[model samples]
Target: MNYQLSLTVAICFGLLVLLGYFLPDFDLLILLRAEILRWAAILSGVAMFVGIISLLKVHFNKFMDQKSNWGYSLVLVLTFLITFGAGVFSFIFPQAEGLVDFMFRYVQVPVESTLAALLAVLLLVAGMRMVRYRRDWTTWLFLAISLIMLIGLVTIEAPIPDVFPFLRDWLLTVPVVAGARGILIGLALGAIITGLRIFTGADQPYGE
Candidate 1:
């Protein structure tokens, strides 16, 4: 039954996409695409309730089984409940903007900023390691260009040659960006193929 449903949906979607691409004048196809997305978002939101239950079950199990980081599990549960409570309170008392705004600013902003900073530092370290540890001319060339660009970006009047900025712009706007975009396009194509395979039952998220 699942297979049949999947196959039917896949064929219908495949036909819609093909037809949309072929007949670009009519926007009924585009509307259909948007409608699918709208329904998908609604269904996905509904599915999150099941996800929440599953998450609680797993984390509670970890705490019950006395896992190594049970304290972390307890903290997670506490934070989840507190945030949920705040949301419910906000819904109940829509006029109480102070409490909700304070929690949003104090609790969420700092955590998000800290995570972003950590990610930036990690990326910087990875880039440095690649430049420092690699034993190749291409890597050295990349590192040299990166250093020049960074310096040029930081110091507006650093007495660098006029060509440095030009070279940096070229490196960024021409080769590096083009190569990254090409890779992204390839990755998107691969992902689409994989998703189509899954939709057609050639690949399954769950084991057969």
Candidate 2:
């Protein structure tokens, strides 16, 4: 009985939202949709805050307990505190904007750049390992494509023919765009399927 009521409520709200989107002439639906969406946004923000607090608590406990690798957790806690403190100060006193910007540039930017570099290095190492073990055309092709892309990224003119640069541009513009669109299409289809499942009661959320 409770499950049926929950399913009925879900279907009603789902229809209200879909109708509000498709039929903007219905003022009541538009208002209901706006209120529902606003509540969702508020809930999302609260959830995010809870998650951050939970993360800090976990790391603080790990550090205080003096577990293995506690030093890393200590570093993380200190970094978070410093960053958060700086952000709060900057927000309270607009004159301290420079302090926030400095931390972002010196700390965050370098960390992100290092991660990106590690990703490239890891990918190269993985490709080499695959080629060594497999010794197949596909592995060789993968390595060749990676090399060509890296060479294309260089601003300096290489000793090789001009065709490499053209090939790189074509690959970026054509295959990359096509692949990105395909991923978006897949995501949209998945979302649609999920909505249908919810509406049809195939996926029950409020069940005990």
Candidate 3:
């Protein structure tokens, strides 16, 4: 009974949202869709809050138990508490908003940048390993392009190849844009399929 009720509501809401998109002149469908979307956003916020509480609970317990790799758990707990505290404090007193900004600028941004650097290094290492094992033209091409991009970052007096900057720009503007568009097309198709499946009751991800 509960599953049927949930399925009916989901399908109806999905149809309404679709209708609102297709029939922009209909104020009734537009209003209902807007309200539905707002409620969905509220529910999403609640879900995120629940996830944060669960994450903290698990990490705090691990830290207290002093389990293997507990140091990472400790860092996560302390960082979360400090960030959350600052956010709450700023919410109460807008003048102290700089506390939150400092946490992001000094801590969060650096951490993210460090992770990005490490990811680039890892990708280069992986490319090198692939070259050793495969010895393919594609692998060599990838390595060559990567090298070009890295060299473009250096503070050299002039481009070594004289066309290094142009080549790098062409690579970024052409291949990267094409690849990104392909990915977006795939995502749009997948979203449409997901919506269709939900409308047809082909997928009941809500429950069994």
lDDT of each: 0.81, 0.89, 0.90
Tens digits of per-residue lDDT for model 2, 1-208 = 8888889988888888888999999899899999888987998999998998999899999999998999999998999899899999999999998998999899889999999889978976887789779997978777787888888778876587788889899988998799899999999999999989998789996674
TM-score of model 2 (CA atoms): 0.73
> What is the Å distance of residue 141 in model 2 from its true position?
2.9
- Summed backbone clashes in each candidate are 0, 0, 0
lDDT comparing candidate 1 with the true structure: 0.81
Which residue pairs come into collision in candidate 3? none
Runs with alpha carbons beyond 4 Å of true place in candidate 3 = 133-137, 144-184
What tens digits encode model 1's per-residue C-alpha lDDT throughout 1-208?
Answer: 7767766777687667666778877799977766776887898998998899788888888988999999888888888888788888888998864776788899899989999889978988998898677879988887788787976576655777778778888888998899999999999999989977866667656532
**Candidate 1 Cα misplacement greater than 4 A, ranges:** 13-35, 131-134, 198-201, 206-208
Judge candidate 1 at residue 33 and give its lDDT.
69
Q: In terms of TM-score, which candidate is stronger, 1 or 3? A: 3
User: What is the lDDT, from 0 to 100, of the residue 153 in candidate 1?
Assistant: 76
